[model samples]
Structure formats: C-alpha cells, structure tokens
Target: MTDEHDWAPDACTLPTAERPLRLAEFDRLFRDAVRDTDRPSPRRLRLRLDDAAEPVVRDLIARESACCSFFTFDLIRPEGDALTLDIRVPPAQVDVLDALARRAAPAPRP
Candidate 1:
C-alpha cells in the first residue's frame, strides 16, 4: 500500500510522524467493520458496518480525529443491526478518501 501521507499536501491535517501506522490501523479496523460502502456524494463516502462493530469503529474514529482534523465523521445508527460512518473531506481531497476506501476493501478470495 502507498503511504498516503506522502502524497497528501504538506499542510495535511494529520500528524505526519505516525501516518503509516495509522493508515495500517485504519485498514484493519475497516476490514473488520465494513459491511457496505459507497460514495454518497462527490466529497463524501458512507461506510455501513455491522452494529456490533461500533466500539472498534468509534475508537478508530476517535484516534483518527486527533491527527486528521479535516475529516468529518458522523456515526449513524438506525433501527437495525447496522451503523453508518459518514466520512467527508474537502472536494479536492476526495481522492485521499478514495485511497483509504481502497485500502479498506477486503482481500479477494484466492
């Protein structure tokens, strides 16, 4: 996987030092939590996850918030066994989120 922080602007919102590690963590959390995902708009992606995945998802988002201030995360739980993570970024930074989403994709069966 590419080091996302490398291509992100110099003024990136996330702390630089631990970006690689954080990205790895994100991949793991997403692999475990993601049930469905789609781009809801040009600048936003909605990730639906199993309700039981909430704790890990919440923790990951909380840690991500500390370094990436530009991300807008909304956790939505409806009357079901699923939760939604609405992630938004600046229009120009949509690609950044795309890269993350790609990383979150589950490995294909061999």
Candidate 2:
C-alpha cells in the first residue's frame, strides 16, 4: 500500500462554489501544458504556469506526482513577485481527473 499521505492538500478545505471555477481554470492550464503532444499517463497532470519560478514549482510538481499521493493537486496563484501553489483537490477531479489529465497531456505519436 502507498503512504496515503503525500504532500497534496485536502480538498475539503475549499468552499463549494470556488472549487468548480478553480477546477475549470486548472483544466485549462493543464491542457495547455501537453497540448498537441501524445498519450497521457493516467496518473499525471501537467500544470502550465505563467511563471513557475524555475526550480521551485518543479519540486512541488514532483512531490504531487508520486504514486498513490493525494496531495499532488495544487492551485498556482502568481502575483507580482510571489507565487503560491495551494495544494487541494477538487471533488470533480478526485480519481477521474488523473485519467482526464492524461488525455489533456498526451505523448507524441510516432
């Protein structure tokens, strides 16, 4: 069994209405990452950041991508010189999101 305790945030913390809109935004962001790529893996979601701050987001992204990790999902809000990735899962994306994310981030076909 997996640790069941990755770094991804709890989805329960978000208010109901705010969650959906954010998911939509996140969906758009994720789609843009692997756009016109190839087949996506069922366990990954690529976040397209306007400013990922180099190595910082990459580390967080790695943490979230670990297997059986619930905390892999995060919300990135960038303003001025600050960027915050609020780790939380949306109910809509719980398990299904991963597969859909793969569809969003596809691998290039040969």
Candidate 3:
C-alpha cells in the first residue's frame, strides 16, 4: 500500500476482496507513513468515519492534524466509500506541535 499523506489528493481505491480496504490496513499504512521520530504529537485524534466499521471493508481517509477545541464534521463525501478520520488537536498546543512537526517532518522534497 502506498503511504500517501494527502488523503484528499490521493484518490482512495478499493483493495481486491469485497468492499474497499481494511481499516486496520489503513491505520498501519498511515501510522507507518507518519511515524514521528522525536515524539508522537499530542493531538486528540478521532476517526469519525461514515462507513460502518464492520463486515464490509472500506477505504479510509484517516486524518492527522491540529485544530480547534471542538471540530464539527460535515459529510462532504458521504456516499463515497471511504473512511474519514477527523483528527483534531487542540489549537492551544499549536506552537509546540509546530516545533515538533518541523523537526519531525521528512526533509522537504526539492
């Protein structure tokens, strides 16, 4: 599986079997992709997925971000067979995250 950070940019595809892709697979892929060497960001992550997390496997758009105190999700692509992980990190902790992320992010691709 390709570790594409921009879930929106990289269109999700269905893995051969039945539905889309396993949620666990998505987690493994993304977690590996965003492996922070220094320390894991203190973001209150939540996967507010529309698809039923069950029998039917589906591709997931797992979010990893920093945001406002309470984040309200709007189902922009409800019909789309993809999981939505609305990652929300307290804004109060932005600066600390910036410092950490800057140091953690892979060297900018020229």
Candidate 4:
C-alpha cells in the first residue's frame, strides 16, 4: 500500500498523525469489500461493493466527508442486494480521485 501522505491532499483537515490510520481504513474497504470499480468521469469514481458492506461503507464515507469536504459521496441500492458508491470531486481534485481509483483497483490474479 502507498504511504498515507502520498494521496492525501493539503486540503484534508485530518491531522497528520491520523492520516495513516485513515488510509488503512480505506485500504481495508477496498481490499475486502470492493467487488468492482468504474470511472465515469475524471472527477468521479464508482465502486461496486457487496451488500454486506453497506454499514461500513456508510460509516467510512461519513468520516471521510468530515475531513474531506471536497468529496461528494452517494450510496445507491440497485436491484437485489447490490450496492454502489459514487464519489465525486471538483476538477481541481481530479488527481486525488485518480489516486483513489488506483487504490480501489483489484489486484491482478497470479
């Protein structure tokens, strides 16, 4: 996993010391719950997650929003038990979104 500081932008209000912990949280979510990923636009990312991940996803996004107000998160329930999370940022924050997309990407099968 990349260092916590690598993708975090200066606008993040989260304290420096807590950055790693936050990054770990995201990594955990990405590694365990993310089923697929899609980039609808430069500033938008979509994550398809297992139905069981809804609670954790909600909590994580809430906390992330507290620190990174520039982010816009939407949780959607599409037919059955499917869950989708859409995240958006301003044009200036496309790089941050790009970094997140990289992290959320599934690892290649050996």
Candidate 5:
C-alpha cells in the first residue's frame, strides 16, 4: 500500500494508530486472495477472490464497514469457486476508491 493514510478518507472513524493495521489487513487480502480486479466506473471497484477466502473476506469487509461507512461493499458468490466483491463509494470519496484500486492491482512482473 502507498501509505497508511493515503486511501483513508476524512470520513473514516478508525483511530490513527489502528489505520496501519487495517491497511495491512486489506493489503494481505489483495495480495493473497484477489484473483482479478475491474473498474466498472469511477466510483466503483470489483474484485474477484478465491472462494476459500469467503470467511476472511466477510470478516474484513464487516470491520471495514464499521470504520469506513462511506464504503459500500457487496459480496457475491456466483457459480464455481470464486467470489465477487463490489465496492462503491460516493462521489466525494472516489479518490479514496481510486487509491484502493491502485493498491489492489497486481504487481508488475519483473
């Protein structure tokens, strides 16, 4: 992730000391479970995750929602061994979403 506070918006209720821990949690999910990412709109982001990650995904999103009410997370389990997570933010928080998308992106191959 860029920085602990980079993607966090002013509306977030998470305490300063805990921001890095939360960011690390998100980074871990993106690195280990995220299979794909898509941007259907400026204010929305979609992540395809391994089906086995459902429990962790659920727990993470629930905690995230508690702290960041501006984020609207929708978890969908379609057929097959995959789960889709759609994240939406209001217009004012699009920048935060953008930062999250960047963080979720796969690292370049050397």
Candidate 6:
C-alpha cells in the first residue's frame, strides 16, 4: 500500500500532449538498454550504456527531467565507446533515485 504523500511525481504530472508515451514504457526500455551501474555515493549514481543507445537515452532523460525536476542529470561521453549518465539528487529524493537505479540494472543471466 502507498499514500499520495509517499508517491514520487510521475509522468501523469506532465500535460497529456507533452507525454508521447508513458514513463513506465520508457523506463522498461531504458532498463533493458542499460549495461552497467555505479553508485559512487549515496546521493549520486552513474549509469552506462553503449553508444547505440545514447540518442534514446538522451531523449528519455529530457522527458524525465521535465516531470521530475528534483533530479540533476549529466551526460558524459568518454573517448572510447560508452555513454555515462550521472544523476544526482537531494538526500530526500535518494530513495526515488535508488528505485530508478534498481529498475535500470541489467537482468541477471541464467
């Protein structure tokens, strides 16, 4: 069970015209594309993906930021091949971010 107070702001907050697709759909695809995750500290997380996914990831981040203004995202492209998405948030929002990280983590192999 969950209360309104316990809920995080979701895609519903955005205007219907602005949301081409639901957040859950984007998150599902995003999680599948994520290759790695690193948590340097309690307040920050770094998610890595191959170059091919960068454009979609960038679009996703843009939409996510519009709905969830509390989070700060930095996209870094290294010299080699991967793209890193660094996300930071206030301590109170860490739980929300953690949930996102958990969702984004790659599925385990059989």
The per-prediction tally of clashing pairs is 0, 6, 0, 0, 0, 0
Model 1 per-residue lDDT at 68: 67
Question: Against the true structure, whose TM-score is highest?
Answer: 4
Off by over 4 Å in 4: 1-5
Model 2: lDDT of residue 75: 45
Per-residue lDDT of 58 in model 1: 88
Off by over 4 Å in 1: 1-9, 13-15, 107-110
By summed lDDT, which 10 consecutive residues of candidate 1 come out lowest?
Answer: 1-10
User: Residue 12 in model 2: shift from native, Å?
Assistant: 2.8
Give the per-residue Cα lDDT of candidate 2 at 91.
53
Total clashes in model 4, counting residue pairs 3 or more apart in sequence or in different chains: 0
The candidate with the higher TM-score, 4 or 6, is 4
What's the CA error at residue 91 for candidate 1, in Å? 1.3
Q: How much is 52 displaced in model 1, in angstroms?
A: 2.2
Q: Ten-residue segment with the worst summed lDDT in candidate 3?
A: 64-73
Return the TM-score for candidate 5, rounded to 2 decimals: 0.91
lDDT of 5 by residue, 1-110 (tens): 24535568778899978988998999999998888999999999999997888999999999999999989999998776369999999999988988999889977769
TM-score head-to-head 1 vs 3, winner = 1
RMSD of each: 2.7, 11.0, 14.3, 2.3, 2.2, 3.9
Report the C-alpha lDDT of model 3 over 1-110, residue by residue, as the tens digit.
22233222112233334222343454444433433233334653323333444222222332311112232223223464455333333565444334333433444549
Candidate 2 per-residue lDDT, tens place, 1-110, comes to 11222212343344446545544544555544433322134444444444544354555346335532555555454556333333333454445444444434544669
Cand. 3 TM to true fold: 0.23
Task: List lDDT for all candidates, in order.
Answer: 0.75, 0.43, 0.35, 0.90, 0.89, 0.72
